[model samples]
Structure formats: structure tokens, C-alpha cells
Target: MTDLVIRNATVVTCDPAGTVIADGGVAVRDGRIEQVAASVELEAAAAGARRLVDGKGHILMPGLINTHCHAGDSLFRGLVEDLPLEPWLQTVWKAEGAILNPETCYLGSVLGFAELLLSGVTTVMDMFWYPEETVRAARTVGMRVSTGGIFFDPPGVTGDNLKGRIAAAERFFEMFSDAEDVFPAVLPHGAYTVAPENLKTAKQLAERHGALFSTHAAETRAEQADVTGRYGRSVIRHLDDLGLLDERTLLAHCVHLDDEEIQILARTGATAVHNPVSNLKLASGFARVPEMLAAGVRVTLGTDGAISGNDLDMWMALRLAATLHKAVTGKADAVSTAQALAMMTSAGAEALGAAGRIGSLEAGKLADMILIDVKRPHAVPMFDPVTHLVYSTARSDVRHVFLSGEQVVRDGALTRHAIGQTIEAVERLKPRIAASIA
Candidate 1:
């Protein structure tokens, strides 16, 4: 018997074919989709369903995917903004460098996960300091997470620290390896933050365990100039020279790549994650997604984090990604709604290394999806569901969210705890974080 059934859904499957079935129904059993058929067909197929949600006036689609984030930075939202990457990392965001303890990491992850779940992001790729704390927060909040411990060339974290970092990452993986909610990966911070030697070491570590290696690529003009000036090659070319761009690499930002870089990414089967809002806020140029697509590069979307984006809302980022490419290239057909959907869905799943399991509404795929309240004023007169998703919808329209067939959000509210609870947590942390500022 089916455990739950949702009927009367305007099903917008973000599949390759982009099929939209009106008055559709989905049956869930054992954390997988059992059937997707007409409401009457589903009702007749699954007798004695334990629960039924009348998904009237709702658009049911796979949950939005956030391919890159710094969960530990959410608490620092608005703490540093309107600054370049180098200056922001050096000064205003310096508090995190010193003050980010286990408690702060967990608090920030909790806060970040709360915002993400509410905004219809069911899964994320996190690069943060405290991997254990990130797992704790994702487990507590009931969201799917793929995180990697950071590797950088700081005075404190040397080549010797790689051993301990790898150990910690292994411990995290072993502890949560069987848990469906948390998946572990390794993260190399960025091109300028870590030495080339460290990047090589990180690749070896990831290869040993057959894991994904993610890093920040050319996300800003300064980074691009710094890399070229230092290495006499573009950032992507340098990575290619070092054999870093491969099937396992997930490069974040990717704002300043040329046609050669695009070809490298395409040939290497590497994934590029676009953070439009964060890039724009930091005055970073728009990603050449259209060019990248033509080059066959797999592109996905991410919110970056609250520290950079001021919100863990993927909906806003997806919209920005949909429009910014067209606006930047002066081509109306730059990024179509279908391409935007792929960026926010399957492409992100591929980045998170869960491509076959989630990111779509396939029968065998994991039951991860969101129900948008299409009854809203702005959601009315929906000519095309995919178009409405990119051009018209807001985060507030998310009515119900699920991860692995379990409801994490319902009635447009989080299911884990009360808003009052999150507010109290944030309120408490606000004063402490503010007081710690020097």
C-alpha cells in the first residue's frame, strides 16, 4: 500500500523532455516514487493509502537544488557585503576566520538550512570549516547535504593539517555514511586561497576515496587577473594544465572563462555552478552560460551563501540566472526556461554527485519535490509552468517540501521547528556574534 498520495497536482517534471501533466498524482512508498499518473488512476492503483494531500492549485516539481553554499557563513549574512572578494575575505568577513567554532558552525548551518528548506531547496553542496557541525545541522533540520572540509594555505592550516582534515572528513563520512540525509565530499577553497601543491594533494585524497573535488574557479575579475598575472594563464587553463578539471570536479562561480576555458570544461566533463546574485552583488561579471552550453559544459546554479548573497534562497538565484545571461549577452535566447530548469535541478544533482537518485520526478528517483502554491495572485494565468517557475514565481509560493519522501515543509512553513524557535536561535546568536566583533 502507498504511504502517501498527492493528487490534483500541476506536475512540472524537470526531465529531459520537460513534460507537464495537469491534474496529476504522485504516490510515495518507501521513500521512492511509486507511481505518477492521473489522480483517478493513482487512487485506483493504491488502495488504502495512509495519507492523502489534496494538491489542488499547486505545481508539483522536483525540489530546487543549490549546487554550492557556505552553510557556516549564513550567520554572517549582511556582515560583509558590497565588497570585492579579496577585501571581503580580508576584512569584513575576518570575524568568521577567527570566531567560527563548532557552535557557530552548527548555528549557521541550522540557520542556513532553515532558509534553504523554506525556499524549496531540498539539497545543497556546502564548503565550510566544520564538516561535523554541518552534518549535525543538516541532520537536525532534515535536509540533504553534501559537504567537504575546506583546504587552504593559511599559516595555521599547513600541508600537515591535510592529514588531520582528511581524518576528520573520513570520520564524518564513516559516521554518516549510511544516513540518507548527509553525504561527504572534499572541498578545495579557491584558486588563490590554496597553493597548487595543496590542490594536487586534495585531488589525490579525493581520488583515493572516489569522491568529488570541488573548488572556487574564476568568480571575479580580481581572481582572474591575479591568476593570469601569477601563472600567465587563465584560471581554467591553469587548472587544466594541472589536470584539475575532470569528471569529478565541480567548479563554483566560473564567471571569467573564455572560449578555451569553456572547451576545457566541456572536454573534461567538469561541472560549473553559477551564482548570479552573488556575482552581481560583488560586481563579478555574468557567467557565459550560453557559450558554455554551446560548448557542452554542464552548468548548475547556486546561492553561494548569505554572507555573499544575503539569503540561502535558490528561487531568487535561479531567476537571476535565467534573466542575467540574456541581459548580459544581449541575446533573448541566451538561457531558455528549459535550460534554467536543468541548472536548478538535474545539473545541480550531478554537481552534488546524486544524479541518478534525485533532481527529477522519475518513478525510481528519490521522492524529493516541492508543491508551489499556484493559487497566489502572481502565480495565476500560468501559460507555461516552466516559464512561470523562472519568470514569475517567488520563494513565498512554496507550500510543501519533501526530502526522501519525508515532509520537511508544509503549509508554506518549516516542519522541524517553529518560526519562533528559529527567530529565537538567530536572536540569541545575533547578540553574541555582534559582541564578538572587534
Candidate 2:
């Protein structure tokens, strides 16, 4: 017998051919999709389902995947804005040192996950120090999280030394190796923070453990110059020489790649995660997404962190991604609605190494999906669901969210804990967070 069945919805199957089914339904058995067909067909097939959800007048699609983020950085939202990458890093690092701990990390992660889940993000790739705590928070809210111990040499931080951080990362990999909803990764802060030798070691560790290797790369001109001055080559070249460029690598930012660098990424099969709103907010230059896509580099989208991104809404990023490149290149077809949707959905799942299982709404994939209410004013007069999703849909339009066939968000609210409690927790920490930076 199936666990749940959702019927009478516009099912958008983000498949290889972009299939859409009107008045369709989905059957879920044991947390995986059992069938996707017309409502009448599923009514006959899914008769044994324990629960039935009426999805009438809604758009049911795959859950959005956030490819790169620092979930613990949500606590620092608006704490330090209007600054470029370097100065912003200095301020954030200080704030992290002063106020960051396991408790606070969990709180910030809960806050971030709550925000993301409300906005239709089911899977998130987070790079933070207290990964175990983050995982705990994710579990509390039913989020699929990819994370691991972070490697960086900033003073006043635990594992401030490379050796200590690597040791911690090894421990994390073993601890979370068999975790169900968690994907272990090795996250070095960046080329600018980590030495070449250490990056090579981290990459080797990730390879040995069969985990994803992620890091920030080439987000700013200043970063490029610094890496060039130190390594006598671009940051991408240095990483390539260290054997860090591979299919398992997920590079964040990548907002400043040249033609050669783009070609290198394509050749290595490494994924570049574009953070459009964050890039524009930080005044970081735009990534050559059109060039990268044409060159065969797999590009995905991220909101970065709540602070620089201002919010964890993928709809905002989706719209910006759909429109920004066109505005910059004067080409209306720079990124199509389909391409933008793919970046947020399938490309993100591919980057997370969960493509075969979760990105698309297919028969055999896990039942991770969202129901967007199209009966609203902004979404009215909908001609194309893809266009409406990419251009008009808002996070508030998310009516229900599911992960592993379980409803975690219903009627626009979290299922487990009260969001008001999360807000209160963060509000209580605000004074200390402010005092730390002050």
C-alpha cells in the first residue's frame, strides 16, 4: 500500500524532455515515488494509499535544491552589509569567532532551514564549522543536508590550524558516513584561506571517502589578484594543479572566470554554483553563465548566505538568474526560463550527487516536491507554468512541502516546531550578536 497520494494537480516533470502533465497525480510508497500519471489513472492504481492530498489548482514540481550555502551565517544577516568580499569577510570572521558555537550554529541552521523549506528548498549544501549541529537542526525540520567540518586557518576559531581542522573533518566523515538524509562533504574555505598543500590533502580525503569537495573560488577581482600574486597563476589554475578540479568538486561563486578557466571547468566536469543576488549585492562581477553553459560547464544556482543574499528565497535568485544575464549581455535568450528552472532543480541535484534520486519528479525518484498555489493574483492568468514559476512565483506561494514523501510544511507553516519559537530564539541572541560585532 502506498503511503500518500496527491491528485488533481499540474505536475511538472523536470525530466530530460521537460514533460508536463495536466490534471495528473503522484503516488508515494515507502517515501519514494511509485507512479506519476493522470489523476483518474492514479485513482485506480493508488487505491490503497493511506492518505490522499488534493492538489487541485496547484503546480506540483520537484523540490528546489540550494547548491551552496552557509546556513550558520543566517545569524549574521544584515550584520555586515554594503561591503565587498574582503572587508565583508573580515567582519563576518570576527563575528563568527565571537558568537559562533554549537548551540548558535544549530539555531542559525534551524532558522535558515525553516526559511528555505518555506520557500520550496528541500535539499541544501551547507559549509560550516559545526556540521554535526547543523545536521541535527536539519533533521529536526526534515531537510536533506550536505555538509562537513570546515577547513580554514583563521585565529580564534576552533581548528584554527590546518592539521586540527583536517583531523576534525576526518572524524566528521566517519560519523556521518551512513547518515540517511545527510551527504558528507569536505569543505575547505577557499584558496585564499587554505594553502595549496592543504587543499590537495582535503581533495584526496574527499576522493578517498567518495564525498563531494566544495569551496569558494574566484568571487572577486581582489581575490583573483591575491591568488595570482601568491601562486603566480589564477585561482582556478592553482586548484587544478593541486588536483582539486574533478567531477566531485563543487565550486561556489566562480563569478570571475576567463575563457581558459571556463574551458578548464568544463573539461574537469566540476560544477560552478552561481549566487546571482549575492554577487550583485556584494558588487562582485557577474559570472559568464552564457559562456559557461555554451562551453559545457554545468552551472547551478545558490543564495550564498542569508546575510549577503539578504534572504534564502530561491524564487528571487531564480528570477534574477533568468533576467540578470540578459540585462548584462543584451541578449534576451542568455538564460531561458527552462534553463533557469533546470539550474535551480536538476543542475543543483547533479551537483549534490543526488541527480538519479531526487531532482526530478519521476516514478523511481524520492518523493521530494512542493505545491505552489497558482490561485493568487500574481500567478493569475498563467499561460506557461515554467514562465510563471521562473518569473512570477514567490516563496509565499508555497502551500505545501514534502521530503521523502512526508509533509514537513502544510498550509504555509512548518509541521514540527513553531516558527515563532525560532524567531524568539534568534531574537534573544541578537544583542549578543550585535555586541560581538560592536
Candidate 3:
């Protein structure tokens, strides 16, 4: 029997051809999309489906994917503000050290994932101290997550040594390697924080398991100078020299890259995750996204974390990804609306090696998608759905979110868990969070 059917909406399938179906919806069976066609074409399926959703006055599209985020850091939002990445990170670490445990990490992860899921993000690649807790929190909120053991030189939240980090990463693969909702990865902090040997170890572990390897790279000029002083090369060159750049590698914030570095990313097939809001807030210079896109590099989008970005809003990221470059480059057409939207959808799935499964709305892909209400004042008179999605749609317009045909978020609220309790818990922890850096 057909599991579910959604009809009577405009479907913005982020497929390679960019197919848009007016007055269309989708049918699902066994958690995968059975068909995506016009409402009239799906009338027969809707009649037999166990559940039917009317998507009137809405734009149905594949759910957004966030390629880089520190979800647990959501606990420290607005606590350590007005500092650059270097000093800001030191103070942030201080707060994390004082407060973060498995339980607290779980709470923060749930809070961050809740915000993302509600905002139409079905999957996120989060790097935090506790990978197991991250997965547990994602499951609680019924969303997909890509995370694994964290690699840091100093005693971070888990206080794990190099050996401990390796063991934990392996254990993570053992646990969730087969989980449909979990995309396991090994994430080191950054080139500046982790030693070259340690970074290579993380990459090797990821390669051995055929999982993802991600880290912060070239986010600031100071970061470039620091890495050059130590490694005798720029951050991207250093990583490339170490043979760490590849299809499975996700490099966050390639903001300080030269033209050659951009080509290097294209040649190596590594994905660059742009956290525009976090970069702007921290005063890290703008990334060469337009140039990278031109170079055939796969650039994706991310909401770094609430601590840096002040919110986990991919819509804001999408808007910035679409409009920020045009202003910076002085060319009104620097980044196209479709390109910006692809960064949050298909490009993100490609970054995680799940492009075949969850990126687009097509027959046989997972039914991980969202519906945005276009009846809003700002969304009226939509000329192009992609343009509306990139320029006009807000997180608040995400009326429904589905993951594998399950309604994880209905009416803009989480179905598996209530966010009120998470908010209240964070409220209780607010004083301690503020006092940590004081």
C-alpha cells in the first residue's frame, strides 16, 4: 500500500535539470519517494495512500542540508561576543570546558537540531565533543546527523588523548556505520589546533572506514599566517601536501584561499562548506564562493553554530549565499539563485556522499523534504520558486518537514520531542553559561 501522498503544491525538485512542477506533490512508500508529479497525476495514488497531505499555497522542496556546524556550541550563544575567531574560540572553549558533559551536550544538540529541523534542515554535519550524544539527540528530534569523534590536541570536553580519540572514532563507526540517519565522520578541530600527524591520523581513520573527514581550514588571514609559519605553506597547501584533500573531505570556511587554492579544491574534488553568517559575525573575510563555483569546486552551505552565528538558520545562509557575493564582487550576477539553493540542498548531500539518496525530490530517493507556506505576505507574487526560496523564504515559512516519509515536524513544531522543555533547560543553564566566561 502507498504509505503517504502529498498533493496540491508547487514542487521545486532540486534535481540536476531543476524540474519544477506546478500544482504537484509526491507519493511515498517504504520511506522512499514513489513519485513526484502533478496533483492531478497523483490523484489515484492519494486515493489509496494511508495518509494524504494537502500542500496548498506551499512550495515543496527537498529539505536543506547543513554541511558544517558545532551544534553543542549552541549552549554558548551570545555568551562570548565581539571577538575574532582566535580569542573568541579560547573563551568559547573555556565555557565549553566548564559546562559541557555528555548530558549537557545531549541537551544542546537537541536544542540545535530542533532549530535546524524546524527551519527545514533534515540533515546536518555537526562536530562536537560527544558524537554518541550528538547522534542520540538527532534521533530524539528525528533528523539525520553526520558526526563522529572529535580530534583536538589539548584536553577538550571529552579530555581524550590521541589514543582515546582514535578508539572513540572507531567505536562510533561500529555503532552507527550502518545507521540510515547517521553519516559518521572524523572531524578534527582545525589545522591550527591539531598537529599534522594527528590530522593525518583522523583522515586515515576516515579513509579506512570510507567515512568523511572534515575540519576548519583557512577561515581567516591570521589562520593562514599561523599555518604558514608552522608548515611553510598555506592551510590548503599544507592539507593537500598531507594528502588529506579528496571527495570524502569536507573543509569548512575556505575564506582565505588564493586563486591556486580554489583550483586545488576543484582538482581534488573536496567540498568547501561556507558559513557566511558566522564569517560575517566574526569578521572573518568573505569566501571566494563565486570563484570556487566557477572552478568546478563543490561548495556547500552551513550555519556554523549559534554561538558564532547567533542562530542555526539555513534560510539566512541561503539568502547570504545568494546575495552576499553579488555585493562583495560588485557584479549583480555573481551568484545565481539556483546555485545558492543547490549549496543547501544537492551540494550538501554530495558533500556527505549521500547525493544519490537524499539531495533531490525524485523517484527512489528518501522522502526527506519540506513545505514552505507561500501564502505569506513576503512570498506573494512569486515569479520563480527557486528565486523565492533563495531570496524571500524565511525559516518561519517552513510549515512542515518530513524525513523518510515520517512527519518529523508538523505545523512548524517537532513531532518526536517538544522544544519548550529544551528551551526551559537552556534557560536554567543560562546563568551558568554567562558566568563561565565572566
Local distance difference test values of all predictions, in order:
0.82, 0.90, 0.95
Candidate 3: misplaced stretches above 4 Å?
A: none
Clashing pairs in 2: none
lDDT of 2: 0.90
Q: How far is candidate 2 from the true structure (C-alpha RMSD, Å)?
A: 1.0
Task: Tell me each candidate's TM-score.
Answer: 0.96, 0.98, 0.99
Q: Candidate 2, residues 234-280: lDDT per residue as tens digits?
A: 99998998889988899999999999999999999999999998999
The alpha-carbon lDDT assigned to residue 434 of candidate 3 equals 86
lDDT of 1 by residue, 362-402 (tens): 88889998999888789878888889999988988998998
User: How many pairs of residues collide in each model?
Assistant: 0, 0, 0
Residue-wise lDDT of candidate 3 within 1-438, one digit each (tens)? 899999999999999999999899999999999999999999889989999999999999999999999898889888888999999989999999999999999999999999999999999999998899999999999899999989999988888899999999999999999999999999999999999999999999999999999999999999999999998999999999999999999999999999999999999999999999999999999999999999999999999999999999999999998899999999999999889989999999999999999989999999999999999899889999988999998999999999999999999889999889999999999999988988
* TM-score winner, 2 or 3: 3
**Model 3 lDDT at residue 110:** 95
Q: Which stretches of candidate 2 lie over 4 Å from their true place?
A: none
- Candidate 1 residue 145 C-alpha distance from true site, Å: 0.5
C-alpha lDDT of candidate 1 relative to the true structure = 0.82
Error of 3 at 91 (Å): 0.5
lDDT of 2 at 290: 90
Better of 1 and 2 by TM-score: 2
